[model samples]
Target: MIRKLTKDDQELLMALLRKEPALNLFIIGDVENFGFEQDFMDLWGEIDPADGRIKAVLLRFYRSYLPYADGPFDVEGFAEIIRKDNDIHMISGASEVVKAFDGEINFKQVKQLFFAELKEMNNKISESFSSAEPIKKATVQDVEAICALTDTIEEFESSRNGSRTSLRKTLESNTGRTYYIEREDKVIVTASTSAENSMSAMIVGVATHQAFREQSLASRVMAQLCADLLHEGKSLCLFYDNPHAGVIYKRLGFQDIGSWTIVNM
Candidate 1:
């Protein structure tokens, strides 16, 4: 059976989500930050008749839908819920699970990326992997500079989708943070996290200036960011489709857990 979830279901909902915390970082963060009653967010669950326990979870945050299950689930039933909501512009989650919704959801594009998580740092990676200059954690004042730097990286050019307002809001809300390296007063290398909660965070917007590419600048920034987050006892996760980028993350102690798919409607 499928039903809308309320705060009363928090215990059940969190139990399922925490099973793979890194993979569900976004959903966990949203629930932690906005909760179930928000107009912009809603949650639903599929319960098993035999156990009366949640077997699948679906989340709607603004225009996006995220779905997850430990094993087989009623994909068609969840897809039905998504289809009835015209406000939904995208559906994203573990690729294997999300692909089942393709025919049910009207989407115009699909993005597939390898999902990875970092639980511990590799002993081989020395702290010296970071830049000689300390990486700076960004503040509201760095929004414009970060956006400018974002615009230069092909990988993240469309990642933020040109939303400076959103970027600014993220900074102000403390839901996210950016760690960067600057050269000659210009922001050059950056690695940021979004959808941060107490247990996990998703790494996004990793970019380095074109001139700084071969110098391991991106790795430096990412290493520092991941190290700090891990030190705080928060696991980190990221999405990457580029093989070269995958190599860098592997060296930083991230391993592929699954494939993440984002379908745009």
Candidate 2:
């Protein structure tokens, strides 16, 4: 049965979420940063009666995001539970779960994504982009450039459905990093994490200028960023739907975990 989660269940919750860090990045990061009890957020779960382990998990963020994860789920039952809420921005998680959900819930946009992870780097990628643009971590001095890049890149993201984040706040939070390749003072490629925790980091904002594709600029920045995070003792997680992009990441050592889906409601 599905029920609300409380502080009393924190340990039980963390245990389940940690199993697949890549699939549950949002759930793990929010719980780590904001705690279990908050005025605007609520978490619920389905428990397996035989073993008492959580079988499915759901997180609702004030109608902005409702993310779910589980292998075996009663999608219709859970969909009915979420139907009671309003203004839900999206429902996201395993493609099977979310796709099944989109069939039951009215939605505005339905997106399919592939989730992958790299436990170890194949070999040190030569950062020797001697003749190429150098990848550097963005400082507060680089916010405007980052924003400009995002604005242009996002437009091509799914015919204008790409999500845009305030790079301004990302820099202010000081929790994650955005690495980019700059050519003659112009930002061309970027790789960054959208959420992070002590054990994991979720990579997002990964894009390259169309003119710069096929140059491996994205690979370079992503490799460097992943190395840095690995040094800090964090595993890397990312979601993508492009086969070409998946090849690049696999070369750097990421393997497919599963299908992740996002439905804008």
Tens-digit lDDT string for candidate 1 (92-138): 99998898876777779988989999999875675656438778999
Best by lDDT: 1
TM-score of each: 0.93, 0.84
Q: Would you give me the overall lDDT of model 2?
A: 0.77
Worst 10 residues of 2 by lDDT: 155-164
Best by the TM-score measure: 1
lDDT of 2 at 233: 81
Clashes of 1: 0
**Candidate 2 C-alpha error for residue 212, in Å:** 4.1
Q: Go through the candidates in order and give each one's C-alpha lDDT.
A: 0.86, 0.77
